[model samples]
Target: MSFGALSDIRIVDLTQMLAGPYGTMMLADHGAEVIKVESPTGDMTRPNGPWHTDDAQKTHGGYFQSVNRNKKSIVLDLKSTDGRDALLALVRDADAITENFRVGVMEKLGLSYETLRQVNPKLVYGTLRGFGDPRTGHSPYAEWPAFDVVAQAMGGIMGITGPGPEHPTKVGPGIGDIVPGMMLAFGVLAAIHHARRTGTGQFVDVSMLDAVLAVCERAVYQHDITGTVPAPLGNGHPFMCPFGQFPAKDGHVTIAAPHQSFFERLCDLIDVPALKDDKRFASPELRGRNREVLEELLAAATSCFTKAELMQRLGGQIPFGPVMQMDEIAEDPHFAARDMIVPVEQPGSARATRIAGVPVKLSETPGGIHSRGPYLGEHTKEILRRAGFTDSHIDRLQAALPA
Candidate 1:
C-alpha cells in the first residue's frame, strides 16, 4: 500500500528518460502518487535492457524499472487534442507536474507552464533541461540538446575530473543527469510547500549544466581564492596527504588521516611509527608538500598486506575503507543490514533480481520499493477513472494514442 509523507500528494509526471524520471522517482518512493504519463509507444528506456535470462516478455528493462518503481502509467499522446485534454484534466487536481523536454516543445504542444498554470494556478510546474527554460533565464545554449556527456563537459565536472587537465574524463556514472534530477526533486518539493502555504505556485527550473557546476562547487571557490584553475589530481586531494587510495597486495584501500593524531595512529598501525616523526612528514603541511615521498612510503608499507588484511588491522581505527568492486559490495553484509541492496521479482521470471534500495531512511513513515515499474499503460483505465473520465472518454483518449 502507498503510505509515506507524500501519500496524499499526486504528481502528473510527463518526464521520461533519466534526469526527469529520477526526480519524480524520488517523490514516488516517498509515497507520492506519481502518475507517469507516457506515449503509446512508452518511455524510450522501456526497451533499454540487459534483460533477465529467465524473463521472456521483456516488457520493461532494468533502466526503466530502476527509477520507475511505485508509479502508475497511462498513455497519452500529447500531440492529439483528446490526449492534451486528458492531461489537463489530470493536472487540474495534481499537486505538481514535471517535464524534461527541451525548450519550446511544451509550448508547441500547447501545454506550456503558462497554459497549465491558467488551468490550475497553484500547480507546481517543475522542469529539467540541458540549459534552462527561457521563461526563467535565457541561455545561449538553451536550444542545444544535451545528454550526460555534454553536461559533464560543459558544466566544469570534466574539467576537474580524471587524472589531469590534459586527460579529463567523464565520471563513471551519469552525475550530469542524475544530480540535476535530484535538484529538480528538491525544487519540486520546495515549490509544493510554497503553493500549499500561499495558494500559489511558480515554475521550477533546473539546468543540467547548472547542476553539474554546483556539484563542482569546491573548484569554483578554489579558483577564485587561489587565482589558480583546479585540475584533476588522479584520486588524491589537492591539500590532504595520505587521504587517497593506496595500493594493497591484492587490491586498493582508501586512507584518510590528515590530522596529526589520526596520522600518528595510522603510522603506528601500519608499522611505520618512525615515519610520523620524520622531518619531512612531521606536519600536515609538510606531509602535503612531500606527498609523493610519503605516498611511496605508505604504498610500500600497505602493499605488504592484502585489502582484507588492511581492513582487519585498521578498519575502525581511522578513516579507512577497501576499494571494493560491485561483486564485493553485493556480498557485503552492511548492504543487507541497511537495505541498500534490494531484490524484486523479475516479471515473467520466477527468480528475483536485485536493485539499489532507498537511501533516505524515515524512521516514522518509511519509504520502500514494494513493487516493480508498471507495464505500458498498466493503469490507464484506473487513472482515467480517478481523473473523472467516463469509459467512453477513456476509449477516445486511447484511440488518440500514437500508433
Candidate 2:
C-alpha cells in the first residue's frame, strides 16, 4: 500500500467540536497519523444529527464521521497526572499537537508549548481560540466560550449577508470553524516544512474572529475606501453588472456577467439585440443605474426557458450555473465524474453511504480516505504498546479512570 504526501507526519489531535478537529482531519486525509485524544465522554459532535441507520448505535453520528475519517481515537483525561504523562510520552516523538481549547486550559494541565518544549523541542504546537491567545487583553470574558455563529456575528459576516436594509444574515455552514481550520492546517504544514529544513518548531495560533475577518477581506477594504458600510445585496454583485441570480422557468441560475464582452455575449445569447443599444442598458454603469429594468427584461427572457434548456443553449457562452440544492448536487453528473462523492461501508445493513472525497489532487502522491475514524479509544492498547508500555502496564493504565 502506498502512503500519501504527509505519510511521515504524526499529529496528536486534542480538539473537540469543529475547528481544531477539522484541521487535524485535513491532515489525516493526506496521510498524517492523527491520534484524537477524546475525554472519557466523547466529542460533542458524536451526538449531533444524521446518525447511523441503526437506532441502537448512535455512536457514529454522521456529523462526527464526516470530518474525522482517517484518524485514530484514544480516550484520556488530561487533568490526571498519569494521562498527562502518557500524552507527554506520545508528544516526545510526534511531529505536531493541535488543540482548540479556550486559552489557559493547556497551561492548567501543565501541557502548554513551553512545558512540552522541555519534552520535545521539535514539537509544532498549534492552537485555535475564539478571541485570540490571552496576550492581547485580559478581556472580562477572556475565558468565555464561543461557537460558530458567535464568531460570524462578532467578525462581521452577519453584517453583509442579507437582502434588505434592516436585515443581516449569517452565511450558511460553519465558516467560522472551517476557515480557521483551513488556515491552521496551512500553518501546521508550513511549520512542519520549516522543522524538516531547519530542525526547529514554532507556535501556530489562529483566532476564530481573525479567521472570519480574513474571509471578509473584501468587505473590510470596501469599508476602508468609503466611509459607508456595504449593505447586503443578496444574489447581486455590488460592482458588477448582470452578475447575480436570475429567475428561470423552473428555478434560478447565477450569471456572472462581470466583463463587457461577457455582458454582450449574454445579451446576444438571450436574443435581446435591442438591449445592446438601449440608453439605460448600453454600458455597465448605465445598466447599474437601471438595474430593475434590466432585471425585469432578463427575467422575462430567462423565465421562458428551463434550466436545462438555458444551459444547453448558453452553457459555454456565458459564466452560468444553477443554484443547486444538496439533493440536486448528489445527482449532478459533473460531480460524479470528479469523484466528489465517495461511498464508504459501515457496520449497518444499509450498505454504504456517500461522503466527500479529498479535494487536493496530486499527480503522484495523491491522498484518499484510508479508513473510517476509530471508535473511542479503539487504539488505546495499540498506542500504549507502541509507547513502550508493557501489556500488563497497558491493562493497568486502561483500567484506571483518570480525571
Candidate 3:
C-alpha cells in the first residue's frame, strides 16, 4: 500500500495514449501523487479494448487500466481560459508536468517551459514527440499525425526486425511508445532530483524515433562504422551463433549460448558431441560462418523434446526459453509469484479484471495501483478544490466546458 521512493512527489499529467501516460504511471506506482488532467472527452485509450465482459459500465479499456492506476483524474479543456488558468495554478505547487503533444502545441497554449519556469522555477517539465523536436531535423510533416507503427518504421526498427528486407516486422508490443515513456520517466526523475538540489527545473525531451534508434543501437553502430546495414536474422543474435530460436516439438525455444563453452555445454546436453569438435562449429566466430548447418543440427536435436521438457532440462543450463504467448504469460507461476499479473476491481463491472503489475519493485516501500483508471472528469470537483477554487468557481468552470 505504501509507494516507496517517490512518496513526496506530485505530478500534473497532461499526456494521452501510451508514452506520457505510461511514464506517469511509473511515478504513480512508486507513490507519487499524479493528477491526470483530461479533456471532457477523456483519454483516447479509455475505450481501447480487453474490457470486462461481465460488466460494461465500469470498463476503462484494458489499455487505460494497464497504464493508469494510483492516480486521480480531472477534466479540463485546455483550450478554455478557465481550464488553462486552473492548470497553471496547479503547476505552481507541482513537482512535475508530463505531456506527449506534438512540438509547439504547449508553446502555442502559452504553457511552454519558459512560461512554466516563470511560475515555478523547480518544476520538471517532460515532453515526448514522434520524431525529435524541430532542432534535429526539418520534418516536412512536422504537424503530421503519428503512432507506434510510424515511429518503428521510420526509426529503423522495422528495417532490421524480420528475416529479410522483404519481410520487415514490427515488435509485438508498442515498444516504440513504451520505451520512450520509460526513458522520459527516468529523465523526469533525474531533473526532479537536480531541481530539488539546485532550485532549477529543466525540460526533459524524449522522441519516439530517437528511442527506437537507441533500442536498435547495434544496427546504428554497425552501419555507421562498417557501412553494412544489419539485416534481420529472425530471432538470432547477428554476431552470436547457437544463440537464437530453434523449433521444439510443439513450439519454438530461444537458446542463448553466447560463448564457446556454453555452446559446448548445449551440444553435450543435446547429445551432439561431434559438433563440439567440428572445426567449422568450434568457436563463436566459426559457428557464425556455419550458422545454417549448426541451426539444422540444433533443430534436429530440439525437435525431439516438447518445450516444457526442454525448459525443465535446459532453462538454467543455458539461457533458453520457449516463445511465450499472452496466455502463457498469464499462467506462468514465476510471473504470478513476482506479482506481474495483478487483479484489479473495476467498480460497476460485473467481474474483477486482471492486468500487468508495476515492474519496478521497492523493498521498503513497494508501489502498486491503488485504484482503477478514473472515469472522465472523475475528480473534477476534488481537483478544483485542491487548486483553491470554491464550489462556485468549479460550477463556473463547468459552465464554460467546450460545446
Candidate 4:
C-alpha cells in the first residue's frame, strides 16, 4: 500500500522554470516517475541563485531545487535526430507528457500531439502556455513572452491586491506561475483518468491568465454582488471585520474573529469587551459596516502588545496567528510536528538544506521527495538505456549535445 497513488504512472516533463515544473513536481511528489526532459543547457533556474554551491558543474539553485525534487534529469538536443528519436521512444510508454512552451514550439520540434499520438495514442499531452494553446483558444497575444508579473497584471489580481488603488502591489509569491502549474497538474490528472478508461487521450491546457483569474474568482462575484467593481481594502476583508492583518509591537498578526462568538472572544482578549455588545458593532453585518472604526479600536490595543504578547493572549482562543518570518517558521514546532520542514541533500553544498515538504498528507501510500534533482543530463544515459537504446545510440546522442 505504500507504493503511492501515482506509483504506476510516468511523466515525460519537457518543461522549464516555474509553471510547468511546479505542475510536474506535484505529480512527482505523488510517486509518479517524472522524467525531466531538458535541453543541453538545462532548466534556466538551475544556475540562478539563492545558491548553496560554488562549483559550475553543480549549480542548481534554490528555485530549481524547491520545485524539482523527486525527479530525474535527462538532457536532450532535440535539434539532433538521435535525441529526438530518444524522446519519442520515451513518450511511447509514458502516461503523460507536459510542456510549457509557446503556441507552436512542440510543432516546431516535430513532436506535436498529432505526431505523438501516432506513437502512443493513449498519451495525455499537457501544455502550459502563456495565454493558452491554439487548440483551446488562440489568443491575439499567443506569441507574446510572459512571466509571473504579466499574468498578475492582466488576470485581475493586481486590481484588488494592495493597500490602495494608487499603490497596487504584486503578491510576494509567484502565484501566476504556481497557480497555473497547480491547475495544469489537476488537468493532467483528469485527462489521465479519462485516457485510462477510454484509451483515447486528449490535450490538457491552462493559461497563466486563466489560472490567475480562477484563483481570483472571488473578485468576479464581488462585482456581481454590488454594482461597483472590487477595490483594494488594505489589509482588511471586503465583507468581514476583524479579519485581516493588524499591527503588533514587533510585527503584524492576522486575526479572523468574524463570527459572533469569535468576535466576542477577540474583543475580550483585546480589552474591548464593551464593544462586544455595543449597538454599532453588535453583529457581523454591523461590524462590517463600521469596519474602519472596529479595526481602529482593535489596532489600538494590538499595537500596544508585542507579537509574542498577542499570541500569548489570543492563540487558539480565536482564529488568530502572528505574521511569522522564515526563521520563525523554521524553528516552529508545528511545522516540525507535521513533517513540513524536511532536510534535503544539496549535491555540491557540503551540508544538506531544509526545504518545505509535501503538505497533503495521506494516511497510507504517502509520497515524498525521493532525492535531490539531478545534475545536468545526469540521467540521460540511464533513461536512454531504459528506452532500449543501444550503447552506440546513447553515445551518439550524448555527443550531439554542444560541449
TM-score of model 3 vs. true structure = 0.96
Worst 10 residues of 1 by lDDT: 344-353
lDDT of 1 by residue, 240-347 (tens): 998999999999999999999999999999998999789999999999999989999999999999999999999999999999999999999999899998887778
* Superposed Cα deviation of residue 114, candidate 3 (Å): 1.7
Candidate 3 C-alpha lDDT tens digits along 174-244? 98898888998999999999999999998887888888889988898899899987878887877788888
Using lDDT as the measure, which candidate wins?
Answer: 1
Q: Tell me the TM-score of each prediction against the true structure.
A: 0.98, 0.95, 0.96, 0.97
In the range 1-403, model 2's lDDT, one tens digit per residue, is 3378999999999988988888888898888999999888888888776755564666666778778888888888787877898899899889999999988889999998999978888889998888877654444556768899988988888888888558888889999898899889999999989988988888888888888989888899999998778777887866777888888888999888766788888888887877887888778898887877788898888888888888987798889998788999999998888777887655433656578878888778878887875788898878877988788976767778654
Q: Give one digit per residue, the lDDT tens place, for model 4 in 3-27.
A: 5689999999998999999999989
Worst 10 residues of 3 by lDDT: 50-59
Clashing pairs in 3: none
Q: Between which residue pairs do clashes occur in model 1?
A: none
The model with the greatest TM-score is 1
TM-score of 4: 0.97
Candidate 3 positional error at 184, Å: 1.0
Q: Model 4: which ten-residue window has the lowest total lDDT? A: 51-60
